[model samples]
Target: MTSIQEKIIALKHKKNALILAHFYQTMDIQEIADHVGDSFELARRAQTATQPVIVLCGVRFMAESAKILNPTKTVLLPAADAGCAMADMITPEDVKRLRAEHPDAAVMCYVNSSAGVKAECDICCTSSSAVQIAKSLQEQRIIFVPDQNLGAYVASQVPEKEFIFFHGFCPIHHQVKPRDVMEAKNAHPEALVLVHPECTIDVLEMADFVGSTAAILDYVQNSPKNEFIIGTEMGIVERIKQTIPQKSVYLLSTKMVCYDMKKTRIEDVLKCLEQDIHEIDLPEAEMKGAYKSLERMVSVR
Candidate 1:
């Protein structure tokens, strides 16, 4: 093993740290991670981890989530500057203002948001659980924050619950146009289109399957078909290749890359493990408040 790889492994053992990487993370980071998954899956794994320190090989919002889920454990984001546009799109004040406009509506926040936004919302949800969470809420009107695409998708599924969506989207996924999906399908005629809910409605309409990153991975693994056109971040293609090398998978658009997710390199992971700086620290009250929404999400699942 190289020095960086050897040192990271050594430090992880020494610090009792478990590295959690998102599906969008680079292949190197994913390979070194003790657990590699999407945001919701990583958070779930972090909750059950026996390690005292958790290193997140993902974006800032993901690290914040790990901190919220494991308050007692130290959560570190290898690339401190790595942040999601969707997460930064809304704030606590914005949620409050929207809440005022629709007093009877429940606030259901996507997990791609920040700790502060989660604290303000009534309940938090992931792409996989959004439809169920929104449906479970007794409120007829729901204010879904920080991703209109996901909100719209969930609203379509649970039509009984009316949704007031927030104007936010993943900068990377937003670039994907419907024509791109068409072109990809034209090239790979037999391939099935699998898309994430963050994708635009136009792209979603072209998809044969719609779900979260974890859900997408699971679909590709279990499906009888051997070919797919993935409609999310590009990193997932690498992940799928690793998991099921025999299957053929193609990206709907090459522009589906998330620079924020790629920011956390193997070098950053090694440096983070060695220095142990950039630890995620939420105020006790902030953490406690956010935990309620997140905890409620888990309970429903």
Candidate 2:
């Protein structure tokens, strides 16, 4: 470890802080994180944290989620400006409007949304739990928000329900076209294609596997196949290369990078711990509202 990393560890211990990172974070940040996982996993970790201070090494929405889960704790976002484009694509007003139009439908907000949006929804879900959550809902009509791609994927899995999708999407994942997958496949014909459900339905249809970042990692680690094309973010590809070196892993597209997730450096984490900067604070009402949706998500089996 570098001197900076050692310093971060020392400061974390001094401050009684727990560092949580998303799977899309840089390897350096992940190395020092007490827990590294996808959104759902990190939220669960945040909820169960024993420490008073929590440093989240991902985008703003992730830090917000941590704060919502652990309202009493100090949740610090290392990169204050690191925001999710998809989260900003929709608003509480939009959710209200959708709910009015589909009164019979239950609102299911993706975790990739603002706390305000979550407060307005009936329940929240992450990519990994979306299908199960949707299936578990009592309402036959579901109004899924933020990322239409993920909503569509969940809808496909639970065909018994009717889904009303929003126009929002992950700009990075939405950029992947079917031709891009075909090109990658042609270059590595023997490689099995693994993609995130955040991709468009057409792209996901071409994938041999569709899962969250953690699920993708687990699949690659356990699968008997030796060669794979990872879809999702470039960080996952780097992680795969580092952890599963024996497997020949390739990125499905070079354009799969999430700029927001890449904003936090190891140095930023050190500064966050030292100064406790970029603390996440939400209105009490919003926190309580979002908590209901998120708590419901966690309670799902």
Candidate 3:
């Protein structure tokens, strides 16, 4: 461990703080994190945190979720400006308007959205739990928000229900064209194509496997295949290469990196722990409203 990492560990222990990180974060940040997971796993971890202070090394929305889950604990975001572009594409007003149009449908917002957006929805879901959450809902008509690509993917799996989708998408994943997949496939004929549902349908259809980041990681670790093409954020490729060195992993597209997710550096985390800067604050009303949706999300088996 570096000097800075040692300091972070000391400060974390002294301050009685827990550091949580998303899989999309840089390796250094992930190394120091007490728990490293995707959005759903991180949110669940935040809910059960025993520390008084929590440092989240992901985007603004993730920090907000931590704050919502643990209202009393101080939640600090290392990079305050690291916001998700797709989360900003939809608003609470848009959700309300959609609710008016489809009164019979239940609203479901992706965990990538803001607290206000989640407040307006009936339940929240992450990429990994979307299909299960949609299936658990009693309503036949579901209004899915903030990532039409993921919504469409879930809809395909849950054919018994009807879905009304929003137009938002992950700029990074959405930009992946079908040709990119073909090029990667042609280059590595032995590699199995594994993609995230966040990618465009055209890209997803060509994949041999489609799942969330954690699911993809688990698949690669357990699969008998020796070589694989990863079609998500670049961080997952790094993680796979580091953990499963025996398996050959290749990034399906060079454009899969998320700028916002990479904004948090090792120094930023140290600064957050030292100064307690960039704390997340949301209105109590918003917290109360979003909590219901988030609670429902976690309850789904």
The candidate that wins on lDDT is: 3
Which 10 consecutive residues of model 2 have the lowest summed lDDT?
235-244
User: In candidate 1, which residue pairs clash?
Assistant: none
Q: For all candidates, what are the clash counts?
A: 0, 0, 0
Shift in Å, residue 216, candidate 2: 0.6
lDDT of 1 by residue, 81-143 (tens): 999988988999999999999999999999999999999999999999999998899889999
Residue lDDT tens for model 2, 256-276: 999999999999999988988
Worst 10 residues of 1 by lDDT: 1-10
Candidate 1 contains a number of clashing pairs equal to 0
lDDT of each: 0.90, 0.95, 0.95
Of candidates 2 and 1, the better by lDDT: 2
Q: In candidate 2, which residue ranges exceed 4 Å CA deviation?
A: none
Please state the error at residue 157 of candidate 2 in Å: 0.6
TM-score, one value per model: 0.98, 0.99, 0.99
lDDT of 2 at 283: 98
